[model samples]
Target chain A: MDNLNVLDIFKALSNETRLNILRWLREPEKNFPAQQAHLPKEVSIEGGVCVGDIQEKVNLSQSTVSHYLSLMQKAGLLEAVRYGQWTYYRRNEETLAKITKFINEEI
Target chain B: MDNLNVLDIFKALSNETRLNILRWLREPEKNFPAQQAHLPKEVSIEGGVCVGDIQEKVNLSQSTVSHYLSLMQKAGLLEAVRYGQWTYYRRNEETLAKITKFINEEI
Candidate 1:
């Protein structure tokens, strides 16, 4: 992505909670509960974890976590997968690599 | 700096103007005017640019520029040196290196 869009990513990552979310998503299996018990089989662990589980893990209000996830998604830091009524969130590793490259060479 | 302080740095850098300021300081000689013309020799261009010059370059009010510089200093993104009546600001290269490492390893 361009520098301006990368600035938006930085803005999204400015918040501590949002930053924590991104870190946690980097290691999904460790952060969230088992899928068969907490999520449907179709929503595999590799795909992502449900928003409600993330809300519970973060101990924030559902809307707040939802908002943070949406902001990260907009910045291309995270990807949201819709399966039935549940919205699963996962880190966009490729975009993250781009961010790392931007930091290394640009800012 | 710790992860928490790094988050504060990210918060300080969230603004476009603030981020631009950091990038400009990366090449101070290129971005600001010569010291002999605008500032005293003892002030030393290597130390930093006078806050007035930064304000002029940013096209913002003195107080606004001062506030941004102060915030950046508090976050360890910039260092402020007081020479006579002028406060000169420059990039904290060491702290920036630490931030880059943090992003590489942590988040």
Candidate 2:
């Protein structure tokens, strides 16, 4: 729960788009495709939701979503995995917990 | 711990200055005046850390610190109180807890 680290985590979650992306990841099937026919089902499941599905749900261009995901991943709020042509993203629960505890202890 | 509300809190803490302000508030006596001779001790105590003290620690202009405080207060991260000529601020623990829980459950 270092003060500087907590600040970094909070800075990461500050954006409206990144915050929404994390929320959407909570229920991937509802907010994102469970399977994309063009992509292998196993790939989607093993890798998590693809960037295209996230882009569509977020109503942003593929480049924009990709950028946002990269930023969040750098901030340690998300984990990225690639399966062939598509990239999938999921919330980083460990960092998420650390962030929550940091806020509780430091703030 | 609504998503929008959590977003607001995160946005408030996103700034380096505002984040430092919260950390300073954690140990008021060390970072701020215990009493100002020009002002009432009770006023400083009940009202919390004066804007001037915060300005000094943050190394920002009076107007800038005032603006930052106003923004954080609006985002529910701080509580402000005025007594006589000076205003003081304190962290809003309830909102802090809500934010922590929101991240744990939603993020």
Candidate 3:
């Protein structure tokens, strides 16, 4: 695990759309059923949803969603996995735990 | 407890100075000993440190510090108690715990 930068995490979460993306990722199966249905059978969707699906759900431009996800990934709030041409993103549970610990014990 | 406004709390914590202020508030005796030493013998300093002491410690204009403190207080990250003419501020442990729970359970 890398050192968690508290300021970066806070900055990544400061925007409503970015925050919503995190929440929506929390229950991907329920929130992104359409994306799940269209998954390639050979490749598991277990890693998480692709950026295109996330963009569709959030109703934002591809570039904007990618920017938000990039910020979140850099902040350690998200984990990205690349499968062939598509990229999947999911909540970084370890980082989230660390953030929880920070709030509980630190500032 | 009030409905924890996670977005507002994130916005409140987005600044380095504000974050440092919260960390400094964690140990009033160590961080603001001078303020502790100057407390009126009759009045209790138990609530927290005064605004003036916080402003001096942060080395910012009174208005800037006040603005920062106000934002933190409104976000439920800090609690302010008015004593006579001065207002003392301290971390709101309840809200902090709620935030911890939020990150653990929610996003």
Candidate 4:
């Protein structure tokens, strides 16, 4: 991984909607409903929180939540997995550790 | 500190100018020139990197750089100090740790 600016990481995290999505993923069972047809099973596992459950919690249109998740994933904040007709998202622990070390040593 | 959204922090850090300012702060000696008028001594200390040096490195107007630094500081990414006629800024370690932990545990 390249040198990641603290500001860049912060910027990616600055949105209310995006923040809620991340928080919801922390406890998938409590925050999300059971997986439906459009949901992925790993929404409760390692892969990620299912897109449909995320959409429901954020109360946004499916497309908008999807876009926001994509942005965070692109910035190395979230990881995505596809299964059947659904996509699941989860935090990337490696990047999380790197960000912590970066802030500790560089910032 | 309240729960911080990863996206909110990321959004604050996304700008190229803000990113460069942070990078320069990592090694104040090599990145900034000798402090001149309107520059603070803590550009080399725990207090922070001077505003003028940040202005010079980012190649932005004084007002713009000042605003950007203030925004990051507001978001709990940077800490600012006002001394004499200059302002110096440094990262806020507490907030940084919080952010890293939030990403690890929540995201």
Among the numbered candidates, top lDDT falls to: 3
Instruction: TM-score each candidate.
Output: 0.88, 0.87, 0.91, 0.76
Model 1: CA > 4 A from native: A1-4, A36-47, B1-4, B36-47
In what order do the candidates fall by TM-score, top score first? 3, 1, 2, 4
- Candidate 4 structure, TM-score to reference: 0.76
Model 1: lDDT of residue B22 = 84
Task: Compose the digit string of candidate 4's lDDT tens values, residues B1-107.
Answer: 46544454566667878766776776666777774445445444463677877887788898998889988888777888777766788877677788667766656
Model 1 clashes, total count = 0
Kindly give the stretch of ten consecutive residues in candidate 2 chain A with the minimal lDDT sum. A38-47
Off by over 4 Å in 4: A3-10, A36-47, B3-9, B36-47
Superior candidate under lDDT, 2 versus 3: 3
| 1 against 2, candidate with superior TM-score | 1
Q: Candidate 2's residue-wise lDDT over B38-82, tens digit each? A: 565444454368788789888888899999999988888889887
Cα distance off (Å), candidate 2, residue B71? 0.9
RMSD, every candidate, angstroms: 2.4, 2.7, 2.1, 4.0
Q: Quick one: ranking by DockQ, best first?
A: 3, 2, 1, 4
Tell me how far the alpha carbon of residue A66 in candidate 1 is from the true structure, in angstroms, after superposition: 1.1
DockQ of each: 0.60, 0.72, 0.83, 0.50
For model 4, give the interface RMSD: 3.6
Q: How well is candidate 1 docked (DockQ)?
A: 0.60
* Model 1 agreement with the true structure over A1-107: per-residue lDDT tens digits: 46338777878878878989888887877887864255655546464878987898899999999999999999898899877778888888778778767765666
Off by over 4 Å in 2: A1-5, A36-47, B1-4, B36-44
RMSD score of candidate 1 (Å): 2.4
Report lDDT per candidate: 0.79, 0.77, 0.85, 0.71
Error of 1 at B21 (Å): 0.9
